[model samples]
Target: MLIGDVSRHSGVSTRMLRHYDALGLVRPTGRTAGGYREYSPEDIRRIFHVESLRSLGLSLKQIGRALDDPSFTPAALVSDLIRWAEDRLARERELLERLRAIDASAPEGWQGVLRIVELMQGLNSASASRRQQAVLSRPEGVPMSVDVLAGAVLTEPDPHVAGALRWALARAGGDGVAALAAGVRSADVDVRRRAVRAIAEMPEAPDATAALADVLGDPDATVRGHAALALGGRGVTSAVPVLVGMVVEGTGDVEAAEVLGALSRDPGCADRIVTALADELAAHTEDSAVRIRLTQALVELPGTTAADLLRELTHDDDRAVALIASAFVGVLDRRSTEDRDG
Candidate 1:
């Protein structure tokens, strides 16, 4: 087949085919008697492989090596590809997260803010009263009372009403904490679960740290998961052990993976984080959101371990992971070049 035939069949432009030839990525098998380049069926196969890898975000040099190396296994090539993909996905997710934060904090009219504040206060007062009643009535065991309250708080007719309830729970004092802590023992799963979420956000509360640590052992996975989230938000290093334990025990649980990923962000937890990812114990179990979080956390690690793991992840089965790894590689490469110049 001629170069044009290979280009048409491979979906690579003629110029790109020439460029690949120049880079030794998919060179023709030989030249015809008339001085035209002739690509064999094998060359066409290589052309398609090169095109596929290029589409996957491998650099020309990387693609060339992949083509030249007969010893490179499919898994090895895919692994390389995953690193590139993971980096790209990480960059996109970071941008998206920043956008979300901006949207959430966007300026609103004074009237709107005031209305939101009023709704929050009212909701908080109502929730506190209900919680106090539950505490007084059920002191030892409440069937579904906590669940009922949680349902009311989360499913409130208005967004402002829900936000208000959250704000009020966040601001509750000693009595509020005690009531919530007691509620965690409620027989109603929903009640215990919601209470855990509310309590996690009370980072400034006197006993918030201890309360969060206690809930880490909640029988309900949702409660335990929320506690992990709260620990991250509170930046409480005390929760690291519990979180890591969760990672080890719940290696296949997506929620546990999310928490482990978050824990990896703290500078103090870098070693543990890298160990977890490198081991690939809980790494592949991560859901899309957790994978994004993991990529971000991995990017924060300072050593070659992080880079190597990321490079490995570039060929992950998950496309999102691969994209993020690619973006990370780009960032690392840029930083490396910058340091060399400096």
Candidate 2:
């Protein structure tokens, strides 16, 4: 086939074909008598294979070496990739261990207690962790060591480990729920925060929303923030009003702003976000970050009201905030002018 034909068939431009050929990555099968390049069906197949390898994060030079080496087997490449992944996991585990040790020696605080839990969970395998979770679910006749492990796991720093505990709690049925509820009530703020996060990821059962909502009132600001974030992740739209209330009433808490920003992405929550932003801007004059974020959140929604708010924010008192707002307004204006011209 001609170069044009190869380009059309492979969805790669003609220029790229010449570049690949120059690099000796994918050479055409033969040259025509008139000196034009010609590619065979086999050449196209080789191109596809090269592209596949490139997609797997292999550089052109590495790919060239691999193609040149006849001893390279698919199994060997796969094993290499697996080893890389294992190395990454090892590094993560090491970091978690160090954090855990620090938390252990530190004075009794939410961060320290939570770190211990996170450390224990990280050390256990999925199967062993699941078994510990099972014991937590039962809470009765379980060994003291298992119970202690369960408590520790609940405070595990890794969200994945906490998620496993929540899964076990759900599977344990009524008894598990009771134990999980106890975790939420722990004096250690980190345990409560992790519990809220874990429960948010799990399937919403009876009283789950109410229980999470209660955490929004926890004395610790971090606990309230996690609860808000968890509720957002769970898509608990029923909590929109409560989230709006927090954004307005929970001044000095950036977490509420984050939750409101998340909720603003949903059309159902757009109006509440607009109202909250308006109220916040009016009540707190120095909160430029909130104003900027609020403007951004509003622009993501569809409707004239949000557009109007963005326009007004473009001239806000805060220079940084005004710049962001102006940029969005400029984009909309340009688009509108382009539509008119077209």
Candidate 3:
């Protein structure tokens, strides 16, 4: 076939076919009397082959190596192509996320867009101080996209930056709750931990409360402990068991005990809190440390049941536990005497 017929038949443009010939990717093997390029059947087939390889994202140089080098195996090249494509796809997705966050901010003009972009860059900066400044530098009274703030909070590894993000998120109020809730369900344990910590500081709105309640059973004890304490402070009785468990397990037991103390202020919850603590005391009687911690937790509770539990603990078989409980009993007595005199 002549060059014109080859171009028409194979759908390869004449210019491209000539370029392929110049690069030796597909050279015509025949010529007419006029010395015009004439392509043989094999030459047309090579053109199709080059097109096929290009479809797989091979660069022209790589395509040349692939077609000409007998030792260049497709396996490694294909794997590399897959990785490159995946990386490109990830970049695209990240860019799309940034665009969406910006759009959500509803920037009034180019300057507003520039500010939002600056904020995003700050949040993503390599330096922890930069990320901290990003969150702190958000202009007051100007609404930032809650999703942006929540995203920052979820991935922030620096404790200081994470704290600042959480404060900003909480200040954003319930708007960020849904995003943080999604973070709570993230498979990454660190992300889930961050999510719960941020949500724990949110106002006790139903959505925020529900989010904490939902994660109460998280596999991470730290996550569950934080959630339980947050819920307990919000007067949610469901946290009682987990709080008692924290006391028994000695993870954040002091904070757990303090939250339980606050929860016991509710008349209906006081007996349940005392009984839950008593049950743990019964179950963990063999663990002196557990007994001592539970004993001290009982001191935070009001009413006779807790006081009674303290009185009983004073005679505990563990001498250390008994001594600690004896001291607590005296403290409670003084509190009772002071209440009566007042």
Highest-scoring model, lDDT: 3
Q: Model 1, which residues run further than 4 Å from truth?
A: 1-160, 172-174, 237-268, 281-297, 300-302, 315-324, 336-342
Which candidate has the highest TM-score of all? Answer: 3
Q: Report the Cα lDDT for residue 32, model 2.
A: 97
| Model 3 Cα lDDT, one tens digit per residue, 27-119 | 899888999999888888888998999999999889999989999899998999999999999999989999998887787888888887888
Worst 10 residues of 3 by lDDT: 172-181
Q: Give the backbone clash total of model 2.
A: 4
Q: Which runs in model 2 stand beyond 4 Å of their true positions?
A: 1-152, 155-160, 167-176, 233-269, 331-342
List, residue by residue over 44-117, the lDDT tens digit for candidate 2. 98888888887876778778878888886667776787788789889998677656544434526665455445
lDDT of 3 at 228: 97
Expressed as tens digits, the lDDT of each residue in 1-342 for candidate 1 is 998887777788999888878877778999999988899989888887877877877788877776777876668768867887898899898556444433333426555344333333343455655444332332222122222233345435444544555555454333445546655777888777656766666677777678778877777766776777677556665555555445445532445455555665666676766876555435555566566556655675676778888887788777887899889988998999999999
Q: What's the count of clashing pairs in each model shown?
A: 32, 4, 0
TM-score of each: 0.43, 0.47, 0.92
TM-score computed on alpha carbons, candidate 1: 0.43
lDDT of candidates 1 onward, in order: 0.63, 0.66, 0.88
> In model 3, what lDDT does residue 137 have?
84
Give each prediction's root-mean-square deviation over alpha carbons.
30.1, 25.6, 2.1
**Number of the candidate with higher lDDT, 1 or 2:** 2
